[model samples]
Target: MPQRTVDTVIFDLGGVIMSNGKPSDFASRFPEADRERVIEIIMGPYGQDSDHPWHRVERGEITMEECRSLNRDAIIESGIMPILSTMQPQGQESSSTGGISFNFSLSEPMVQLIHELRDNDFRIGVLTNNVREFREWWWPLMDFETVFDTVVDSSEVGLRKPNPAIYHLTMDRLGATPSRTAFLDDLQSNVDAASALGMHGIRVDDDPSAAIAQTRLLVQL
Candidate 1:
């Protein structure tokens, strides 16, 4: 076990604190045809292309409407005209109770751990890489300002994780030093980035309860 030098703790929202109710979760919202079409689109050229509109959506450069238009165009280019009506309905799912809902409500153990950390006077932050369109729903659930001393969203900052600048921005915003911070992320790439920056990075994954226990042990909390 690593010795505790952790003065700050940073968490990633999606897949860490909350689930990413993305295409899979939204699938039931659409008609069978639309769902099949969407699956095809995701598994085809659009998925292969880094410059796909989905990337634009992820980077916050495009609005949902713009992305939808772009996706519709992509489908057309693929020699299929996607039924926009079906797609529209899928996008109408409520933000609050969608597939992306936080599971922590059922994981009381994790919730208590979070409260314990806060009570122990640790500085905490929430950093997430997310599409801007879902902010209205996701942000309120995370309650960044209430649970964390600082919040870093890639959509708002234009720099996503695995990117050192985003990490620097978080540090700068919180006036924290990398050496004193412990970063938790479900992604190894993000964890590696934080570790490279001289921060303690814990990869939180399946059996996150064990991971959390390990984390508490790491920081000697």
Candidate 2:
């Protein structure tokens, strides 16, 4: 079968391109119900919504330093620290900002995959719910100019994943419509949001191979 032709491809940054120490990743640290409870506190209302402080940090509404301080204080005040204590790895240090350390790293073949797409003349764009502080560390790791046509960071734009507005902002900036662009994210909720808005949404979990495979199938790359 002839490959479907796509001009624009949007990639999610965190889980898709890099790893982050997410609270959910420590589920084994707590007992079943306890882990669920901790996760609920961490995510809060509107899970991953702009209203969340973590989202605020992503939008540049607060500095990472401040966020860390606030999160620790809140956890302490709320008595969440005791539970988290059990989850903390021995000798493992939490981020100075009082959260798990999450930095962007180029996932091996995923980097190659992006290059392959670019080499094939696919216009690539990045859409990420990222903090402003990330740019200080993330850019030096990879040559983004060589890889993507545009990037929309939530901290820079004040919009985030699962929000229809943020996706529209990216598509408009990339000058792409939903059908013409393929969107890959590590979260189903985000993929669903993109799909709802007409983008070809490919959902994956932490693994970029799923995204790579889906992209190949979608565009016959």
Q: What are the RMSDs of all candidates, in order?
A: 5.8, 3.9
Clashes of 2: 1
The C-alpha TM-scores of every prediction are 0.70, 0.80
lDDT of all predictions, in order shown?
0.66, 0.72
Candidate 1 matches the true fold with a TM-score of: 0.70
Per-residue lDDT over 1-221 for candidate 2, one digit per residue giving the tens place of the 0 to 100 score = 45556778898876676664344553334444476666655545323574566767877788877766656665556565443544344666546435443344667767787888889888889998777765755677787766788889988998888889999999898888888899988777789899999889997666667778988778768
Candidate 1 residue-wise lDDT, 113-167, digit = tens: 6778889888888887666766765665545678788878877877676778888
Best by TM-score: 2
Task: Tell me the deviation in Å of residue 97 in model 1.
Answer: 14
Worst 10 residues of 1 by lDDT: 97-106
